[model samples]
Target: MTLFRESFATQQSLPPWEARGVQSWCFLFPLSATAIQRYLDEYFNFAHPEPAPFRFSALAEAQFGCLTISYYPVIASTNKANMLRYGPQTTSWDHLSYNEMYVAAPVLCNRVTPDNLLVDRQIVWIQPVVMCDNSSVVFATREIVGIDTMHATINLRPGRAPGSLHVDTQFSGFKTFSPTTAEGPLPFLHLETGSPLPGGLPEAATREDKAFLEGLFGVIGGVDLVGGVRPTTTRLISLKQFRDAYDLRLATYQAIVASTATHTDVSDLRFFDPKEVDLDFMWSASAEQILSSFLQLGRPGDEKASAPHEGPGWDLVGRQVKIKVAFAYTNNAVYDQIETLHTFGAE
Candidate 1:
């Protein structure tokens, strides 16, 4: 069993008040410490490099990004009004929720001008992609968008990689089998799970109270610092494989909502797609990056993607490329565990 109380609840960001706006905030999963560590050592290390700046690492901290950052208020009588600018307004666990795993950075700001000019004193946080049983099965791949909450029209982060920009991402998907289990099926891509998130899945999750299980792990936790998430893609799943996974997920979701009152239709169906075949696009995150490269694995117009074999598939591309898996984080050493029976879901 895993401990899911306060120990898993609240954790402080290390080296607080980073001027560059980069702080290593904790991701408290309900999983066990050992399981997390093993995944980090055996699985993740195999896929990415250790502290590799460009591939998987924490968001690179810039020089003097913030004029000042503070976790506590200091008494500055002469500059009393600006005290809030130097300190964190709230360090309590209110940013957390029982419905989903917490994924947020320590970001706060203060005014610089008298009209209370808010310069970079703004912050943006992309809420975690919580799992939900009520989630409708979306055909789209999983995506993590970081919006500029501070500025009305300015929150997209671009990268040197292909496709779009400003997508500060960390991979977080669930495994089908328990790491503690002797050995079972390889874990499938399972990102959402729980009683139901606050608003429920992303299209997000939630509820008044009750507990559920969920796993939140990222593939490229630090792809931001270098080459912009070289998004080392690897999973080579087929259409049939994806459909099977989708079926199981749909069934699980229906069952959850069935127990609730009049769910009518799938108005509350979870929307994100967390399957192997869905993402893996080269342009995508690891999941997306995988597909883009894998597509090159076969010739063009090949209806289905198959490794090199005498099959009626893409006539242009040739060969079978296998994708590998190992969870990687931007920051190398800091790892944690979540202990729980909660399935990847929402409240």
Candidate 2:
């Protein structure tokens, strides 16, 4: 119940932000347990400030994916502070439109047991890097909830042909591999679904889609049982943190936060052909550095990547094999609500 009034802001912003008619595009890829574990150790280590109360591990079928979501007509939930700050007579800019893209890994979270026996567990996606196109969304998400959100330019739209989609991202990044390169907006990544499978029903979910959804959620909602209800909610985990202002190397606040987005009036769920999906890592030193570890790219003695394939389809460079998609799907939902799961350090 702590509303934030940032020092540079003119008014207080309330939480429980609400959005309607949110669209999401998901492209999943391969990942290994070893690589995921390494990522957790380097960036999201939960073993600090004393061991975490929950046990964390990668899914049996570990996979990494990029979620690009469009949240239109978003509003900061009305409350006393928000009402006073922007009274009814003068309030504008309450509705927002923004796009976000982030890399997430599915993980199994188990409650630590006193008898060394697993008791309760849940599946959640651990988000490491989250980018948004709106500066207001980025600042609010980063400062209030610790989502590690940053500003980027995102272009999300549909192609000329029916059932085709394209999403592109650009971010200000510098080459750590070569420090002399000047920092600028770099082409971070691209996702394009050329077309749906030939003669396939665009309205019907395919077997791959069913299996993928089941793997992620353990049940296929209405598909799993007769007269069953579709699951309306999913959970995501984030490592919320703030660095020490003076030291720059230490965290003044850190915690593990969980957020749930409950979907309603869901429609337009569709699955695309994996081969028809094209994902380009593009040439950004910053993107490569952050995503390569999760995707097992540029590793020594790794030879899976080959020369660029024919045309502008899947290509490989620097051992970053742009494998054909394991699955690609799109859906619409209503997104809201963030809750903290664990706290390690705080002011």
- Estimate TM-scores for all models: 0.16, 0.77
RMSD of 1: 24.2
On lDDT, the leading prediction is 2
Residue 52 shift from truth in candidate 2, angstroms: 1.5
lDDT, candidate 1, 112-148, per-residue tens: 4445354543321112122211111111111101110
In candidate 1, stretches whose alpha carbon ends up further than 4 angstroms from where it belongs are 1-116, 120-123, 128-130, 134-303, 306-347
The local distance difference test score of model 2 is: 0.60
lDDT of 2 by residue, 214-300 (tens): 554443224422111224566777777888899998888778777776655555555566656667655445667666677665533
- CA lDDT of 143 in candidate 1? 11
- lDDT against the true structure, each candidate: 0.20, 0.60
Q: Write down the lDDT that model 1 would get.
A: 0.20
In model 2, the number of clashes is 0
RMSD of each: 24.2, 5.2
